[model samples]
Target: MDFMDFKNKQTTVVVVGAGFAGAAIAFHLTRLGMERVFVLEREEFPGMHASGKNAAMIRQVVPNKLISDLARGGAAFLRNLPLDWPVETKFEQNGSFFLASKKDSEKIQQDGAYAKQCGTLTEWWPIERITEFIPIIEGSPASGGLWCPTDGVIDIHSLMQGYLKSAAMNGAELKFSNAVKNIVVHHGRVCAVQTESEEIPADIVINAAGAWATELGRLAGSLNVPLTPCSRHLFVTKPLDWIKSKWPIVWDITQEIYFRPESGGLLLCPCDEEVQDPNITKNDPLILNMLAEKISHFYPRLSDLPILRSWSGLRTLTPDRQFLVGWDPCVEGFFWLAGLGGHGVTVSYSVGLLAASLIVEGNKSQSTNQFSPSRFR
Candidate 1:
């Protein structure tokens, strides 16, 4: 079909999935004057999966340099969103404390150094200083901690909605409960996508399906990128007056556990990373036991607190655990914005921006080379 004919036939840039990555990509595309962008979400609402179910901590002290850069950019985007965007992206700038005992001090220091190199403000604080912020941690075995004042908690639901609303306002279309079944390629180029109900023609196909990204890529007849979905659980406590809402989110790097104030109580996670299917992962009761044990060994005061609620989500991870962005080397017009892991909420904006840039401007941009999907090839 001719370009005009294709345009008339609903030629669109279909973004599979409606989490932070997909929503933000759609938002940026519309902001850049792309009028026929379509977002496909399997859930009834955007971010109902990993995006909304995460801990929502924005930490720039990622393990990799590229992820650190993305976090920095994404954090800046979140901080400045209120100025230009109509939707309110609620973010609590309560900061993050990464604690480490004598065993993991060197690694903590190395992470702090990397964060510093990435222009993230980090301060090495003695374990005693941790008591000033969180008194319950005083008796913990932590020797020192890296204080990242810029790391904060965000309202995941609000942020996801804001991205969707902004994208919709700019003429991007969103179709929830519309799962992509197959990606139809014509002459080595993506031509259309088949959903459960209908086939939609598309000029470009973006795989932002989060944990289901690997499945989407397979539909396009591409190589299997090593993607795994890991289940992580978060638990909340009943309201406790002693737990101040102003307390910064604290992570015990040595133990792989983190806790922060949430709704007059405490939100805690054991930092468990169990590989699982992309479907709804059930909360592991053993995790609760593990969390309680950790709390008893560390913060003894909250060990007996009643658990209010808990939920689990999958963090999609690549073999290298870094984000996969840019276009596929073998499949023309097929793009990837998956992996992300726990960094999705922290780096969604930057990831989406880079993905959209790669689609509109190709690798001519300076930052595009680092995250290009071709890197895996």
Candidate 2:
């Protein structure tokens, strides 16, 4: 069928992925009184990719100022979820520690100042103070660390479900196993999308497809946005009695490695970033060994801990490492909300609100200009 045939059927806004971005956008749009909104997911359920596989830490101490602002806003929103929300997204106030060496201590301090300027709760802890919270890092780290007290861990599964549930309650439709195959655009504007079984007529198409965003953009014949998928691995050790259940998430900032207490054991990541296609599968043995060796160097006591399991997920990144949020300058009804990288969960709420604001109201905010897709053009 043609655009006009489908256009007369329904005036719907079809979101192409049901992860944090898609679900959150659907929720916000529905709340704003948009009735014909649909969230499409390729998997049988939501958050099957990065959203479900993230480290689940709500960290506010990021390198970029806009990211820090988004993280701050998202963290606050998670802390104060509505009372009637269906799912209970458990927010563990375990805190986060960004350990830095003497060389990078000054930079961390500068970033901490910026974070404070953004109204986030952050403190600089010396080597002595670091041991109070993270006993394992007594003599390992070179200098001090930045302690973000408001930073915490979140149950990502529940958080995604909460967004989807809230969106469904507000009259949004969710279609699972509907992988969008092609986009039907006419007059340089999005009109509909073709899935496996049906043709979905949409007034606007939001590209929240995570790792597959660029491919979707190509399907729509829009601007070719650069999105790279980097694989990050996570390893969890068998439950150990030595580690406390309340241990804060610890990361050696100079070395891109982090570990957090998980069910009496530890969940660790070597922070390995490899450019790869989006596919969910097993963990790489080399990455596991690398993580173990790195843990041995920094955390000798827990290095030999038996690994209970391991898995890998892709973190979609842009060239500057900032999110590409806005509409495609060349395409009329196509919006860009991809390139979240590792901060998807942390900045999801704010990103969704920003996307909805731009789609529904237009770019009227001062901050919105920085994230426009036209920058690449």
Candidate 3:
């Protein structure tokens, strides 16, 4: 298609993933008055990947500045959603506790300060204070914990469905089980995409393919965007009578163990990370062993906690561990919204809004610079 023909195409956009990033992008595009957005998912349904397999907690008091800003922004959005949300999403403000050994207490305090600078409330509590809320918590290894009262659990399924529903209500189309093989470019600019069934033409294309983001970038001839999809596991315990229904998420970073009340039991993790290719992942018994080992070292009383179920998912990341959410420097009309690491759920709201703003305004902001795929180049 010529320039004039493409100009007449009503700014059609083909978003190459239908997970949280793609759904949020489509939702924001529609909210920005862009009606010709189309989202394509390779699975029979959206969120079959990382977006669905996450731990469903939002902890904003993180280590990095830009990432903390995104998390804070996303949390604010979730806390005060508009009335038109199709699903009655629940944002449980059970809060989060970031525990640390005395050796790491100073750093935890710094992290809390950083979160406060980002407008998120955080408090550094003494070991006595932490044990007040969590009577079972041990005091020898843990000097104190950072508390963020706004951090909480969310219904991720309802959240994703809300984005999909809002986008659809605003006239965006979602095509499932459609996979893109290649992107056809004309004169160094995007022209169309070759799917399994047909060639779909579009003036703009978004590469929000999550774990397969790097491969998709290669198909679009974007060779410099470095992305790695890594594996992480989460496990849930059988129902326990002593568990409190609303205990805050407990993350002992020093011990690499996190636990939160779930299903009258507890959801826990060993913070296990493994570099792997993007695919359906099966739970590794080694990870289960690792969780058991960590629990024994940290929470000895809970070492024998019966694990009823376990699962794993991919969290794509860049070398710097920040997100990639801007137009590609090499490929015109090709945008990126990947490498979210494990922050996909916490920063979904801000990341989607940033992508939409960059695309709609067609300008560069600080966020565009911070998350640009060109940084990898």
**How many steric clashes between backbone atoms does each model show?**
0, 0, 0
**Positional deviation of 336 in candidate 1, in angstroms?**
0.4
CA-lDDT, candidates in order: 0.84, 0.85, 0.86
User: lDDT tens string, model 3, 354-377?
Assistant: 998888866445243688877777
**Total backbone collisions, model 3:** 0
Model number with the top TM-score: 3
Which of the two, 2 or 3, has more TM-score? Answer: 3
RMSD of every prediction:
3.1, 3.2, 2.4
Model 2 per-residue lDDT tens digits across residues 179-271: 999999988888899999999887788899999999999999988888899999998889988788788888888877898988778899999
In model 3, which regions exceed 4 Å deviation? 1-9, 366-368
Clash pairs for candidate 3: none
Worst 10 residues of 1 by lDDT: 1-10
